[model samples]
Target: MSIKKLQIPTYLSALSVMIFIIVLTFFLIVGKSLLIPLFLGGFFAILFTPFSNWMESKKVPKILSSVISLLCMALIVGGLLSFIVGNVASFTSDFDDVTSKINTYAQRIDEWTQSTFKMDYEIRNKANPDYLKRVLKENSSNISDFAMKTVGSLSGLVLIPVFMFFFLLYRHHLTQMMIMIYRDRDPNLVKMRITSLRKVILHYIVGVGKVMIILAILNISAYSALGIKHAIFFGVLGALLNIIPYVGPFFGVLLPVIYSFLTKDSLFYPVAVIVCYQIIQMIEGNFLTPKIVGGNVNLNAFITFLGLLIGGTIWGVAGMILVIPAMAILREIFDLSNTTKPFAYLMGEEKEKTQKNEKPEADNESSE
Candidate 1:
């Protein structure tokens, strides 16, 4: 074949890939208003599928099953919100006391720094106290602004359960539609790929849900044992943030550290609180996650981390939570095609298995 022929095909392939990426990015950016609720609805629908199925097995009608599942979800969410609100109200009411304790803690830290560093106390005071106070004040305002904006944005999230209900009600038809769309070109391949994608997403959702619940319980227990104020609030916050992947573990640590700094008169308490978070994360990552999630979703550590970073950049925290499952679905689709199988393997855990046996068979066939 002529050089031009080979070059044209390669160039066209590259262009197609680039265009697909650009289109996807644009959709993610512009479709947020519609996409956010739809995505959340889909996610919750999937999570609640088993419950709906169980209700059906017990002779409940499909509509009733969906309604019951949705109501259960609503009750859980309302309970959690009430707990968080109550704790926040109590904490705010005691704000003056908390501020006084924080100031005393700061003084102790300053004294310790002076003694440990053997620095001139007057110079250190001039450099540190003003800057720290200003930063803290700005951070507090920013946090308040962020919370208000989040609440404003989430006011529409009530639509999620509504969407979820219909999704569950007609899930069988939806799956059938999906299969029909892909069946014309390659039915077997399409079905396999879809099945793989579903397994990956379902396993991840169920696994993470269990992990978050356990971590929440452990954190609440630990905080209670340590006599931390607002134990339930911090524990629940940690669990929710943990859904955001890598950065979430750090966020989980930050809540308790801030509480310790604001409520106790010693840096030791904050350090201990941070240490506790680290320990919990270590347990979750090494033990709980591996056992629960297994190796079902095949994205490697680097790609997984990159997916989170890019997803967060594109769609904020919700993106961070959704990206891994989305990527897994994409990987499943790619793995179905001979042309794109390599890309799927690149994002997968089965790289060695994919390489060693398949290539040799292909080489031998070519030689024959």
Candidate 2:
């Protein structure tokens, strides 16, 4: 065969993949309004499927079973949101006091910087009426824009539960359709793969949820003991942020530390808050996640970071939340195929890479 013939197919394959990715990314960005809820509903449906299954096994009608399952989930979510809102309301009531303290700290920090480094921080003039007016004037449009966006998102929230309900109702049909799509494969193997996919994905998401709850309890107790204001709010926020991997815990700690610094006169409370979060993070990373989640994604630091960046870029916060489990599901699929097993290995931890490479090196040495 001519070199051109081989090169033509290879170039065509690369071009096709590039085009596919570009089209997919465009659709995802444009159709986020439609897609986000659908994705969320699908995930929730996965989580609630067992409950529906149990209800079906008990001779309950499928439609009623799905409704009950959705209602149960809604109640849990509503209770959690209500609790958070209560704490947020309490925090808001003290917002003026927090604002005053923050301004005071900002003034002191501005003075310190000027004295220490001879750098005049322009923000010190922010307290001036003229400066304040200008700032408000400049930000007025932004504030209005933000409020509009918030209203839009709130409207979107109503559709989520509705989507989730129907997803749950029709999940069996969906699953059967998925299996049928793979009819070219051996029926038993396809079934097993589907089963494994469901089990792994469900376990990963549920395990993460369990870990977050435990972290919240730990954070709240520690913050309470240290006498931080809005301990529940900060703790829960920290727990939620822990959903993102490495960078999240730092942010979780940073926010409370800033709040504690501004609210409390004593430096000790802020220090204590930092120490507490660091210790909690150490425990969670070293013990809790391993004991609970355990090798679900098995993605290396490189792959995880890359996934986070890509996911965050594509879908913002929702993308970050969804990407890790999506990667885990992909890893599971890759593992099932001999051709893709190497790609799966690449996604695994450093130790796996080291071991795999060492085996080949050892074999080569033995032959030598």
Best prediction by lDDT: 2
Q: What TM-score does structure 2 among the candidates reach?
A: 0.82
Q: List model 2 lDDT by residue over 1-368, tens digit each.
A: 65653455778988997999899889977877666667777778889888889999999999899889888888987777666555654543343455566567668889899999999876655655344434434553353344334223654566677888898887667767877998788877877778788788788888889999999999999999998888888899799889998778888899688767756887798999988988998999899999999877678789889988987787776777777888888888888889798878878776756899999999999999
Clashing residue pairs, backbone N/CA/C < 3 A, model 2: none
| C-alpha RMSD by candidate, in order | 5.6, 4.9
CA deviation > 4 Å runs, candidate 1: 1-8, 105-155, 185-195, 351-368
Error of 2 at 43 (Å): 1.0
lDDT of 1 by residue, 112-168 (tens): 877999754553334444454556545544543454333226543666788889889
Per-residue lDDT of 138 in model 2:
52
Alpha-carbon shift of residue 165 in model 1 (angstroms) = 1.8
Q: What's the residue-level lDDT of 334 in candidate 1?
A: 86
